[model samples]
Target: MDDLARLVATEDVRRVMARYVYSADHHRWDDLAALFLPDAPFIASTVDGSVQARMTGRDDIAGQLKARNHPDSVLVHHLFSSEIDFESEDSATGVWAMEDIVTRPAGEPAGMHGYGHYRVRFTRLDGRWLIAELRITRLRLDWTY
Candidate 1:
């Protein structure tokens, strides 16, 4: 890729990362769906090995995530240092070190908590960037700390 194309692709990849965190933290299910390909595979798991779930396709992702996080009182997914490694203009992968905090309003025993790391892959489809695969890994769990 040329200088301008690479720059644009990098910027687009960053926006994709930002949108994922923003949509999840804000509970914008519809908006989140737009960030992925129609048939993308989304995987999320806990670093502690308590939860490991996978959802395929955009519809499933929005539905499943909405159900899982609806009752949460506060959830914020913050992503940073999201650098993309591209094989070409059409494909790339990124590693985003994330810090997420969740607060339960229902007074659950878990209390307010924080977790870490989101490794992601991106694919350019029909001139747009989409998250093809995602893996969430927790580096630390505040509930245990």
Candidate 2:
């Protein structure tokens, strides 16, 4: 791998990661679907024994995100970091630890706080990189009853 190739691959990985966080936080379901391949697989789990379940396909991803962003949940902040791993020039995998804090209307209980980790897989197709799989494992969760 040459220096230029490495730089380009790194940049592509970074851009895809940024898009994943931004689209999820902003509730841009359509954009979020675009972050992955047409048949990407996703599974999100929480420590509270609640599982968001595994979903496949772009349409399914969009549907899941739409259902996740509720009216009471005013905001979603997904902080990703500590990325580690790249298998090849066209394929790689990494980890991203995230913190999501949600806010709600006054009087009502505020939204939950979640800490989780994502195992991300990337694949390049036609010069563009996209997520192939995203498996989320929750470490901690705090929310009102």
- Residues forming the 10-long window of minimal summed lDDT in candidate 1: 105-114
lDDT of 2 at 58: 91
Residue-wise C-alpha lDDT for candidate 1, range 25-81, written one tens digit per residue: 888987997798888888767666666678888899989877766465577777777
Q: What is the clash count of model 1?
A: 0
Among all candidates shown, the one with the greatest TM-score: 1
lDDT of 1 at 44: 67
Model 2 ranges with Cα > 4 A deviation? 48-50, 104-110
| lDDT (CA) per prediction | 0.79, 0.80
| Residue range 1-145, candidate 2, lDDT tens digits | 6778877887788788888888877778889888899999988888965775878989999997677667556666575675746678888787878887776666655467888888889999999989999888889878843
**Model 1: residues with Cα > 4 Å off, grouped in runs:** 48-51, 107-112
The lDDT, on a scale of 0 to 1, for candidate 1 is 0.79
What's model 2's lDDT at 123? 92
